[model samples]
Target: MTKQSSTDEQGDSQSGSARSWWLKGLALCGFLAAIGVGYYFFADQLSLKAIAEKESALQEYRQAHPVLVYVLAFGLYAMVTGLSLPGAVPLSLAYGWFFDLVPAIILVSFASTTGATIAFLVSRYLLRDIVKSKFGERLSTFEESLESEGPFYLFTLRLIPAVPFFVLNIVMGLTPIRVVTFWWVSQLGMLAGTIVYVYAGHTVPSITELAEQGASGILSRQLIIAFIVLGTFPLVVKYAMKRWKGTDARN
Candidate 1:
C-alpha cells in the first residue's frame, strides 16, 4: 500500500510539472505572436520618416484628442519597447514633438521604463534557464560580477547613449538581479538619456529636419553636458565603490 501511494504521488508530481511546462510554452507562443503582429502592422509606422509624412495630421489629431492621444502614445511606446523592436528613438522624438518638455519627459520616461521591464521579465521567464544551462560555466564570472555590482553596471550602460538599451535589457534579465531592482535601476538610469532625446524631439522645428540632421543637430548644450556626465560617471562610481570596499574591509 505504501509503495502504491508513493507511485501515485510521483505521478501527480509529474503531471503537475507537465502542466506547468505546458503553460509556459503557451505563454511564450502568445508573446511571439504578439511580436509578429506588432511588427507586421506597426513597424514601418514607427519610423521617423513615417512620423514626418504624417506630421500635420498627427498634430491635428493630437490637438483634437489630447488625452486619447496621450494614452495611445504611452501604450504604443510601451508596446514597442516591451517587444524589444527598433524605433524607440523615433517614438521618443515623436512624443517630444507632440507634447511639451515636461509632459514628453514624463510620458517617455515611464513608458520606456515600463516597456524595458516587460522585455526584461520576458527574457528572464523564457531564456534565463536556457542561458544558464548552456553557458553556466562561462557566465559564472560574469554572473558573479553582476551579482556584486549589477546596479552600477546597469546604470553605467544606461548612461551611455552608444550602448544599445534593448540588448542591455535582455542581457541583464538573464542575471540573478531582482525584478524590483531592475525596474528602479532602469527607471533612474535611463532618465538622463530619455530627457535628452525627448527634449531634442520637442525643440526640433520639424521631424524632417531632425531626420535630415541625423541626431547631430540635436547636440545642444544639454546633450554636451549629458555626454560629459556619461564620460565621467563610470570612473567616479568605480573609485567610490573601491573606496567603500576598502573601508569595509578595514572595519
Candidate 2:
C-alpha cells in the first residue's frame, strides 16, 4: 500500500509538471506572436534614418497630442526593452532628439530599467524551475557565486556595450540575484552608455551644421574623446577597487 501510494504521488507530480510546462509554452508563444506583430508595424520606423526623415511629422504629432505621444513613447520603449527587441539604441537616440537632456535621461533610465525587470521576471517564471530541476547540483556553486558577485558581474556587462542589454536581462533572470539589485546595478551600469548615445543623438543636427561650416573635424575629435572616457570609466573603477582590496589585505 505504501509503495502504491508513493507511485501515485509521483504520477500526480509528473502530471502537474506537464500541465505547467504546456501553460508556460503557450504563454511564450503568445509573447513571440506579439513581438512579431510589433516588429512588423514598427521596425522600419525605428531606424535612425527613418526617424530623421519623420522628425518633422513626429514633432507635429507631439504638439497635437502631447500627452498621448508621451504615453505611447514610454509604453513602446518599455515594451521594446522588455521584449528584448533590437531597436533600443535607436529608441534611446530618439529620446535625445525629441526631449531635453535631463528629461530624456530620466525617462530612458526608468523605462529601460523597468523593462529589464519585466524581462527578468518573465525569464525567471518561465525557465527557472526547469533549469533548476535539470541541473540542480551543477548549478549550486554557480548560484552561490552569483549571490556573492552578481551585481559586480552585471555592472561590468552593463558597462560594456558589446553585451546586449536584453541578453543580460534574460541571462541574469536565470540566476539567484535579487530583482532590486539587478535594477539598481543595471541603471548605474548603463547610465554612461546611455548618456553617450543620447548625447550623440542630440548632437546629430549639430554635426550636420558643423560639417556645413567645415568644422566637423573638431566636433569629431571631441566626441571621440568623450566616448573614450565613458568606455574606460568602468575599467578604471574596477582597477581601483581591486587595488584597494589588495592594500587592505596587506595591512
Candidate 3:
C-alpha cells in the first residue's frame, strides 16, 4: 500500500508540472500574437505622421462620436502601452489634441499605469525566469536596490526618465515589489511627464509643427520648470529617507 501511494503521488506531481508548462506556453503564444498584430496592423496608424494626415478627419470623427472616440482612444492607448510598443507618445499627443486637458490627463494617467502594470505582470509570470537566467549577475544590482529602497527606487525611476519606461516595468516585475505599489508609483511618477506631453499636444497647431520643432520646441519655460522639479526630486527623496531612518533608529 505505501509503495502504491508513492507511485500515485509521483504521477500527480508530473501531471501538475506538465499542466503548468502548457499554460505558460499558451500565454507566451498569446503575448507574441498580440505583439505581432500591434506591430503590423496598428503601428503606422498610431504614428504622428499618420495622425497629421488625418487630423481633419479625426477631429470630425471625434466631434460626431465623442463617447465612442474616447472609449476607443483609451483602449488603444492601454493596448499599445501594455504591449510595450512605440506608439505611446503619438497616442498621448493625439489624446490631448482630441480631448480637453483634464480629461486627457486622466485618461493618459490611468491607461498608462494600467498598461505598465500588465507588462510588469507579464514579465513577472512569463519572462522572469528566462531573464534571470541570462542576466542574473547584472540584475542582482536592481534586486538589491529594490530590496533596500523598496518603492522609492521605483518611484524615482518613474519620475525620472533615467530608464526607459517599458524596461523599468519589466525589470520591476522581476523584483519583490507589490503590484499595488507598482501601480500607484507608476501612476504618480508618470503624471508629470504625461502632463507635459498632453499640454504640448494641446498647444501645438499641428502634428507637423510639433515634429518640426521636436525636442527644441518642447524645451519651453514649462519644460524648464519640469526639469527643475526633476533635479530636486532626488534631494527630496534623500531627505525623506534620512528622516525615516532616524525615526527607525530611535525606535
Candidate 4:
C-alpha cells in the first residue's frame, strides 16, 4: 500500500496549496475593499479647505488635549500614506501650520517612513510573488542591481520627485531589498523635500493673511520654484557624480 499512501500524500499537498492560494486571494480582495471604503468616506474630508478648517479645530483642541491630538494626527498621516492616498502633502503642510518646525519635521518624517514601510510590506504580500513569477527573466537585472545597490537606488528615487512617493513604496516592495534599508534610506532621502514643504507651510499664512497681503500669488510662485529646485537636486547630484567619476578615470 506504499504506492496508495504516496498518492494520498500528493493529493493532500495539492489540496493545501489550493487552500493557501484561495486564502491569499481572499485577503487581497478584503484589502481592496477596505481601500475603496476608506477613499469614498474620507476623500472629501481630506481636501485642502477641509484640512485647513480641521487644523483650526485641532489647534484649539491641542490646548487641552495635546497628546491626543498628536496621536490622532500621527495615525491619520500614517493611514493616508500607507493607503497611497493624496493628502500627504496637505497633511504635512497642516502639521507645519499646527506645530513647531522641529516637531513637525520629526513627526512627518517618521510617520511617512512608517506608512511607506507598511505599503511596501502590503505590496510584497499581495503582488510580489505574481510579479516575480511573470517577469522573472526581465526582472533579473533589477533584482541583481537591487541586491548590490538597493539603498542608493531607493535613496535616489526618494530624493527625486519624478515618481510619486506612494508609487515608489509599492514598486520597491516588488524588489528584493531589505525592509530596514528601505526605511532608513527613504527617511533620509525624503528629509529635504519634507523640510521644504513644512517650512513653506509654517511660513505661509492662512487665507485671511493672504487676503490682507495681496501678494499671496507671488509668494506662492516663489515657493513652487523652491520646491522644483529641491526636487531636482538629486538629478544634479547624480550628474555631478558621474562627471566626477569620468574625470577621475581620465586622470
The better candidate by lDDT, 2 or 4, is 4
Please list the residue runs of candidate 1 whose C-alpha ends up more than 4 Å from where it truly belongs after superposition.
Answer: 130-141, 161-163, 244-251
| C-alpha positional error of residue 170 in candidate 4 after TM-score superposition, expressed in Å | 1.3
**Candidate 1 clashing pairs?**
none
- Candidate 4, residue 216: Cα displacement in angstroms equals 5.1
What pairs collide in candidate 3? none
True-structure RMSD, every candidate: 2.4, 4.5, 2.1, 3.8
lDDT of 3 by residue, 119-183 (tens): 99998998888767866775788889888877778778887778788888887788888899999
- lDDT per residue (tens digit) for residues 1-251 in model 4: 69999999999999999998898899888877877887998888776677655556666789989888778888888888988877898778768767889999999999999999988998888867765676566456656767765577778878877668876787778887889988999999999888877777788666234324433532576688887888788888878877998899999
Sorting all predicted structures by lDDT, with the top scorer first, yields 3, 1, 4, 2
For candidate 3, the 10 contiguous residues with the lowest summed lDDT are: 210-219
Q: What is the alpha-carbon lDDT of model 2 when measured against the actual structure?
A: 0.77
TM-score of each: 0.89, 0.81, 0.91, 0.82
The TM-score measured for candidate 1 stands at 0.89
Ranking by TM-score: 3, 1, 4, 2
Off by over 4 Å in 2: 1-12, 127-148, 206-219
Residue 158 CA displacement from its true place in model 4, Å: 0.9
Q: Whose lDDT is higher: candidate 2's or candidate 3's?
A: 3
RMSD of 2: 4.5
Task: Compute the lDDT of residue 235 as modeled in candidate 2.
Answer: 89
